[model samples]
Target: MAKILVVEDNEDINEILKNLLLGEHQVIQAYSGTEATLLFKQEIFDLVLLDIMLPGKDGGQVLQEIRQSSQVPVLMITAIGDKQSVTQYLLNGANDYITKPFDGDEVKARIQVQLRQTMSQELAGSKRQEYGHIELDSQTFTVSGPLGQVSLRKKEYDIFQLLLDHPKQIFTKEKLYEQIWQDVYLPGDNTLNAHLSNLRKKLKEVDDCHEYIETIWGLGIRLKEWQSS
Candidate 1:
């Protein structure tokens, strides 16, 4: 069952969501945005249902905070149904939004869709994979590229595998550390940087001309555009 956080200031609405989700999933309720923020830091939830009009640190602000360190699926709850508002929410990082007076079935369906997508992504890298000139073998924890094949340490292998799994997606350092280490990512931690450095060096040794990973300064890392060498 997925762990979901329900952030709604309306007592009735919060209780309604809890009742709707209780039997199918684990639900945590927060009455205000501030409470939701604290709860988020304490737990790793599979999805978040957040109300836009919150008591403190409105939903948009909270979303920015979450995006800084995570890519968790967030479904916004908003009373406004204007196209501009919905567009803004999407641009600001909400996976989806439910209008006020929402239909129960639609809410449930949207939640399911987001959860399924998350599960699919998690399972996508569970096999041998390839991208550009690099190939990763899950069974042996080895990577082969144009130049040669090399066995990687567990952490190194995981880092490379994740990059290969989503070559076009930029992974923030926080997201990488949290996923690979299965722990909270502390700011300024050098461990992920060290592993990435080692991983890059190993890849370079195998294929110097092809840049496999590119760091977007002040943002994250993603696979560089492949070039014919």
Candidate 2:
């Protein structure tokens, strides 16, 4: 089941969406854009159903904010089926658009498409794994670290996922290359270091003080054990 955030001010529309999506997914409702934004930061949503016309910070603005940190699928709901609005939302990073006068079947279909795409991506990775304060969704390429949810590139995600999956085992640079790149690890090659640097930087962005990935001199890399203290 997916965790969906439905942002619509119209009480009737919100109810309809909740009713339509309740059975298959966990639905969270936000009557205004501000509420939506707050809930978004406080929760992890699989997909977002956003209405364009809202009280303060419309759907477009919310989409823009979400794009700053997330690539979660956003399906815009609009009564205005104009080319300009559609183009604007798409350019701003909305995954798809849904016109108002909601059709139950169409809503389900569109949601299915988004979720299916997400599932396929996740399947491309291994599975969901967690360690310490970090949780990695291989399917979604999202890592919930100390700071917040950060979306990762494919290679970074695969590397993190591998480490999370085998937290107790240290993976050498060559092994990581063989596992993730499916290629030989050559000496004097900086590919692994570059990716590892980027991955560490991303994690540090979430929590700078704690080292998430530890480089063991001549050994390999492993996640530091979560210290609750």
Candidate 3:
């Protein structure tokens, strides 16, 4: 059973969610955004059910903070159903969302979907693969080299994996964003760039002397040719 963190300010709603998920999963409750953040840092939960309207930091702020350090699945709980609001939540990294006065079965279904996806990714590649001196352990979601090792967030890992799997193949920003985010790429969207930048930084930390990813000014991005001293 997965461990889930439930963050909601309304006592009644929080209790209802706990009751619904209790038998199938372990649930932790947080009444305010501040408390949710603190609990999240203290525990490693498989999923988070965060309410967009909260007392302390609000759901948007909490989501931003979580994305900074983790790639754990988060299902937003929002009363707002407008297209713009939902779009913002997804772009900000929520895996999914449940509207207020939600149907119990629908909530359960959405949660299951996210959990299943996470499990699938975890079990995708059991063996380690390498390029140059850098190694990727799919099971552990980590990359290591002679210099050091570091764990990568989901997006960062996916970007690296795609490039490593197809060395020398250039992937344009649009292609990368679509494949990684599973959404249409939008102009001026910095999501892919930010993740790529973070991935490059981690690779540099692992092996500083040789670059692993190369950016072709007008073409795209590809794995750098492995060079040996």
- Candidate with top lDDT is 3
Alpha carbon deviation, residue 212, candidate 2 (Å): 6.5
lDDT of 2 by residue, 1-229 (tens): 9999999999999999999998799999999999999998788899999999999989999998888667899999999968897988898899999888978999999999999998887677666676666777766688777788888877798788778778788888889888987768899899889989999888887666677788888998887777775
TM-score of each: 0.59, 0.60, 0.58
Q: Sort all candidates by TM-score, best to worst.
A: 2, 1, 3
* Sort order, lDDT high to low: 3, 1, 2
lDDT of 3 by residue, 143-200 (tens): 9998889999877988899998899799999998887777789999988888888999
Candidates' C-alpha lDDT: 0.88, 0.87, 0.92
Off by over 4 Å in 1: 127-229
Pairs that clash in candidate 2: 122-139
TM-score of model 1 (CA atoms): 0.59
Candidate 3: worst-modelled 10 consecutive residues by lDDT: 118-127
Per-residue lDDT tens digits for candidate 1, residues 17-104, read 9999999999999988899889887787899999999998899988988886578899999998688988898999999999999898
